[model samples]
Target: MTAPDPTTAIDPVTAAVIQGALETIAVEMGHKLMRMSHSSIIRESEDFGAALTDPTGSQLCECRMSTPLQSGPIPGYVRHILKVVAGRGDAIRPGDVIMHNDPYGGASHGPDVAFCVPVFHQDALVGFSVTTAHHLDIGALTPGSCGIVDAVDTYAEGLQFKAIKVYEAGRRVDPVWQILEANLRAPQLVVGDMEAQIMAARIGAARFSELIETWGLAAITAAHDDLIAYSERLMREAIRALPDGEYRAVTHLDGYLDDPDPGRRDLPLVVTLRIAADTLEVDLTGTAPQLPDKPINMPFEGTVDCAIWLTVRSILLDSVTFGHIPQNAGLTRQIRIVAPKGCLANPDFPAPVIARFCPGNQLADTVMKALAQVAPDRVSAGIGNLRVASFSGLKDGRHWVHMEILEGSYGGRQGLDGMDAVDTLYANTRNNPIEDIEMHLPLRVTRYELREDAVAPGRWRGGIGTVREFTFLSDGGFSMEGDGHSHRPWGHDGGADGLTASVTLVPADGAPRALVSKIPYLKAKAGDRLVCLGPCGGGYGDPLARDPEAVLHDLREGLLGPEAAFADYGVAAMPAGLDEAATRAERGRRIVSPPS
Candidate 1:
């Protein structure tokens, strides 16, 4: 007997039904993980993703709430797992669950644990169900297994698992769980989260099996093939619409550990995009060399995934087009990536990657900027990068790790103002609620509000970042991992640049002191206050051309100060309304000789 040809086209109605059913399974898997997880990071912030893939590890569908960064890499992660198991001559069974967190083994980072289970129909492997979530503790130098800026290599980062089986034949592997538990600070939470992932994978596999049983394997496989082909066609059509040309842009990371002043050193990331007919390619040949001691390096496969995501988001923003296009391997049919070896984006082995999010976000921003040269109306200005801060310590003889993702402003687009105090790009994880933080850890929320006057003024004003301050209830240490400190977010079309990010530590009886953007650790006593100020987003269009009414509204809302209104927008701060004549005179004067 021979296998049925997958190229046989299925009815469009059946194909759409199967596609929707697969997507629902992925969503249910994520909901299961969230409901059963022990960590607040997974339950509250929702830092997880779930997906379904074919037997060869090609993604079929993903959960709607999954992070783009995580979902993009699911296929690669699954392929890596299959290869590893094949080398050992191990047979993957329906009840088996595989787990890994090694960055070199196709994971996003050490903290993001991935679990995959083989979905079988009639004792034959048909597909895989996958789930990935950020665990709070992974036995790293820090509590959250991240924000380590000074780590020299992967050994200091955390415990790494390279494609190991955590369950077999529907039974938990006690030894594997024991070894993981022995190394983690919060063993109970870690094991609980791992079990939650396993449960999610199981749910996914079971649901997929039911679909196969109901519809038969031949029809389902045909539908899968048709869906992938349809998406590839759509992606190619989208790419063909762009003019054939080369677009290039450059951006920089703020700090390196080896420099005399880490803040003063700038690491460049250059991107060149080539579009021809129906294909697009991104080359990162001249990017900065990998840092030996800093934790800013990213894995090559993860970097490629980030590039693919940016391209999809930029070209397919419409609901009708995006809805029909499958979020799978087909999306990459028209994209090619060239990342040079040993660059920061594709670093060599042994380099620390706990802080890779900084460079990853910058890569996405750089690609958008390059595309903006040709599609100015379709692209937005630069956005403030993600700033992750972690607070951890021992309390009541138990360890507590509180990792918070501070929200940054997004750049304003052609006709729309940027979103205010929100997560941008790859760092779209939700902000941890103040009440949740206070209830779970030894900290008090002091301030949580938008930074005033931090937005860049333009025709469409950029969004402002937020300020989050915390007072310690007990002695603990804090670690900062992010970028966008020395360099400001760039504005487009003659708009003004946005503000940079900063951290301030104020003692109870002493003055405030500035801290570096990336810190291995900073000890603080009870009653000390730590404030995290996020960077603002860049604006779109000229600030001088901003409407007086918009400027006045900003004034009333406290986002734009009186001084900034007069200096950037040439608008007078009047008691009742704008001084129309004074505004006209100021605009005319500026038009004669624009401020350089």
Candidate 2:
């Protein structure tokens, strides 16, 4: 593990001030990108992250709007770019920006477009501002990068751009633009969004240079070093808080429907976390074999790094005693990863990985579950996996795709219940507004409402799930992909399980049709509708321990219906015409649970 010199110190006030300035710049960069970008993912879903990196490629800070995953592997990505550029460490000139999407070559998932812009001062490279946004259309083999789940190679996944300069000497590279534009379905939109990325990088570079001007080069560099050191120290302290031992965990993925190989069953991902004196090691040695035909493999290092961040963040946020560890590269110093070759985490060439996030989130879940054994009070039950439902086809002679990324509820904790209708982990983005969807695409939200009695029953009831129904204006097709249906979100500490997710389509026929995990291309005529119900959160504690008054409150708010009140919380409702005294008498006759 890298260590910061103990002799060096930064004033608390100065550190806070620098952090605030960097945060402000990050927010501004995001705003600039969103304002200029043409992609719906950028302007609406906001499926991107931004950060400022030191000259050495180390992440200095991430903005509040940015995600921890975005900052985790950026240093790796930068180093990979340098290697591909023929060891030209200093060749990255001022006003030049590089872009790449080689996941195997140390980038994020296939659809996440990344750019690194070098900052120069006095003709010397000072730092690099990196930004990555999820492009809705990246000229993939399949439209919107959906389908092609049975792909056999990276080429089938999408086009791969090696580490190349997209901008040089403040001018956009003509050849790069021509090639990208020629291959994409929406050429103008792609080029426009790429330009937006360049602008965002420029914004970050200018802000960073301004900071240097305000606080001489020496002071800024010292501050950067101090920040890294402080983060490492705090992370080590957090590690010390955990018991020293080896803990093993494992999670399974819903097998791909397109895999021709019949021998493979549901893919199981194994994760082992070793907590030592000052370091935490995550090993994926015993993980399942890589699937050459399924789109679920991930770069080993990226997965391990992201999993560690999620687990550590959950502990800090949920713990009674949290630490001050900075969410930057310094936190990574105390964490080590080992992903053996040919495993799901470290697949070889030709492994389809368009849907790597499935196993990635599962890996995080397994690690967190293992950590919960040692720190039960600080951890909650499992959350419903990310549900990515997409609708795509030609609408009014123009091709479009609409994705409803549902953020299901989180698991409940020892003292409190889990959050509902919100994904609390990686890609905590919002659902695209119905208004935006209808206006941009050929779909309308027919019905959007909360699912009734769809929560897991417990003393502390699990969160209720939600449902979204959509109808098509044209006879387009739809597809749904996700997990946590066959396997509901699991509870902990004698808690109850959460409800599983379900999807159904309403036709202009006899009855609503139910769909499976992986839906093929199904044509939806006009007046036809699709309904999606996301999973509920797992419950914490015994159901009988919940207060009756709380149950009544949930009943009043309509979060819990009468059936759930009686079945899950063991609370019966009073008669409609009963007075308070009569209701109390009736309650006294039926309330048999202990004090909560």
Candidate 3:
């Protein structure tokens, strides 16, 4: 007998084909999650990501819809499961589906639920399938999965399923159901959502196994290895394109630990990404201090995971031409991330991190700035901040939890303007439909329209912001916390800063009032209304570079306001032929040196 050559086992072409198949399978896996999920967060809001991994737990391929926010943690989560299973001296038999939510246990965010299932071939563990979904209710002390800050420990956050086997050998465990029901407020929905996650993992595992069988394990493994290497190469090429140098940027948060407060001035977070030929290094040594008492504190490891994924997602989402680049461990072969211990990104276990994105978003902005130092044409000015809106109250005498999240505008890039009212780089979830929300719950959506006069004016105007108003049909009860209202999204180059976010409350009798940046809890009564808005993305270039006709078209199409058409853009809305000449003359007369 002679040893076989790996190349002979699986050619690179076949391996590439298998990789494509796995990518498609990942999308199907997500569809299963959407169909089976119970909460609006996972189903209607589409806040979940799915991926395929090797038996030892390395990410191979994922879906585009998974978004930039979720790519970092799946592999880490799988590694944790493998460690736990190996330490127990027990084999991961088929049907041994385990779930973990502890942010310390490899979760990107607390609400993101990770489901792991091991695939077995010939009575041996061949590979693993992992799925993570943002579950709305984890039986937390708060109404939704946003954990309560008042709780003394994790128990108050919700039921903890620590490496607990929810399903065993392809069968649902009885005790698991009892335990889940005992903790979660919406027992039926929570358990149903979990089942949906299991179904997704099962589909992924089955499809992966079929590929391995058809192509043989050797061929499949070779493809996996080749794809990983190819991804690393492509990323290195991208890195090498940038001149070897150090680039730095910094961002701030409204506040880390305060509820119903504007937040302490600004919580600074500095980002420094070094590109040296084919390698990149990201350091967060000067980041802000972790909030010892706030729910915004997340394990530093989770932060590192999120940041890396954010960078990759931004690059890919910004351009489809970059799709050829594989997003596996190889892509980060030249990347090194450092976050000082006890900082916001990496902290001790059980640190309250319900609002991880507050600082996380800042980290992303800083990273973009660092990238822009070298690749200005490749990056866009900051856009409206992204936030998940939480709404929970009493319905029909029972406690109910509902959350509505929004994706605001993104600033334009070098050539094109940013997209409007869309999910930023961090998340790719959908907005819950007004009809779905009103019909299923006791709330009414009075006004859900784009907020005018919210765009940052420039040669190419930034994307417009959005405004939403909700009327409470039942008693008042709910609270919210998010960013971008106080610290507006900054424009790059010559673009101006976007509008600040706003939230207002219309009382049954009293005048409407402005809302604080973050809210832990607020008492409510029937007929009270809640309105929230998102900021606009920043703009690029001098306002003079914009086309006058484009500005008029925006006015005609409702994308731009009349005031913007005249003031920021310098386009006059005059009457017909004379108007065009007058507009030009007016623009010429007002010409002055650009702002310093």
Candidate 4:
């Protein structure tokens, strides 16, 4: 009998089952990668993403633990690979695994290596299984291949691969492997991670093939289409709920690389969000020009993808029924982005983009600020900066590179305070455990604790950031990529702004010195200590409006000090049954003459 039309609708129960199965396969693929990987970045921190896509390169299901920044760009990476293969007249067959990590070629960044494997059944390509992970090194001037804010161009950043077949016909490509092994300083660790990525893709492909067999190719394809359509419908309905209008927000970067002038900050990122009946558009027209020598530029595709993902998460996913909707290409169908060429959002070719995550996260924050005007109930205040630090040097007579992404605070919302000591916004990776760091590298965690007075006080207090101090066991080179050292996270409504991020270097015998937000490279002695104070999130409403009991609870929890409780929240402590009269008088006085 002829197969049913793949585009036709499938039953709801079967469609849900297929969706769950696809997600399960993706999760299994992630587990396999982490279990088999050698590097602590992948195995311990779990900085990786996995997904299953249809033949046309649309995502069907992604691993639940995948980073939002990494997973959203896989479909674009797949399409770019397909375009290159088609240009060269290359055939994509079963057992073929492709690898790429070129930012200009539609990758998120150079360090994030991606692998795509085609799943075939009945001698026909049905879908793809893909994985992307941040490798420890890729033959860059710096050890981690990232955190080099002063990188003048892409050449100084790291190796760039444009859609190359790493495995053909189930056989490893020796030349590609040799190139990778020769380039990276940590060849064994890097190659081991690559091998794990390949294995994950292969396992995903095999499981997907089995799924196709059990459900039949036609039924599987039908379910995929149905699920995407359902997601699109839900997204459109969510968009329709917002009042149709144009909202604009502008935020600035703190500073650029190699600029000696302390007051020299980059131009502001201007985002104009237009909300129509059932559609949304993000226009980055008046943004700053691209910086050729700094690693702050961003690719156009990446910028668009980031904007779309932020919009979906803030608007559609925030809805009650749409909270469980599948995230696929269809959800972005109603979204449009216009980022002019040579702008900070869409930079020109060869511009260093190793530190693009700073601007990318800023773009998300700008979008949130714009949406807050129309959708206050659905939006939150600004979060912390994106901080990634890399430490490298000679250890045991072998070159070593240890990279770690620090966690920051999340912004406060309507009813709840922001999450504390967690990865905020676009980042979804876990903090590297102190035990893992000490075990893998020559470093010691001296102090890791929550900053006591760093939270933004409001009716619902903002999340507090951490204060981590690391001491090198040996002389090493350190690099940092981050932002928001000067400007703090802005609160919404009548809330207060959050604390800014800061870093300091304290030598064993010398005095302490302050460090910039982005540092190219710094040499440290064996006894040197690096103190990183993360940025706290912004509050949601006025602190004076907070309940007295809530303020007392914050004081009891140590999130707010006793002095701040009396000053910010107008709450005073007394032995007599609660000083309610003094608190009321303090609040009334603040209402008449608010603190400037």
- Candidate number achieving the greatest lDDT relative to the actual structure: 4
lDDT of prediction 2: 0.72
Q: What would the per-residue lDDT of candidate 4 be over residues 268-298, giving only the tens digit for each residue? A: 8888989899998889889888887777888
Candidate lDDT scores, in order, read: 0.82, 0.72, 0.73, 0.83
- Which lDDT value does model 3 have at 157? 58
**Per-residue lDDT for 53-94 in model 2, tens only?**
777777776656655455566776777777788665547777
lDDT of 3 by residue, 391-410 (tens): 67665665567877766787
Worst 10 residues of 4 by lDDT: 1-10
Per-residue alpha-carbon lDDT of model 1 for 507-529, expressed as tens digits?
Answer: 87789998877877788889899
Q: How would you order the candidates by lDDT, starting with the best?
A: 4, 1, 3, 2
> What overall lDDT, based on C-alpha atoms, would model 3 receive against the true structure?
0.73
Q: If both were scored by TM-score, which would come out higher, candidate 1 or candidate 2?
A: 1
- TM-score, predicted candidate 1 vs. hidden true structure: 0.95
Measured against the true structure, the TM-scores of the candidates, in listed sequence, are 0.95, 0.90, 0.93, 0.96
Better of 1 and 3 by lDDT: 1
Model 3 poorest 10 in a row by lDDT: 147-156
On the 0 to 100 scale, the lDDT of residue 159 in model 1 is 85
* Residue-pair clashes per candidate: 0, 3, 12, 0
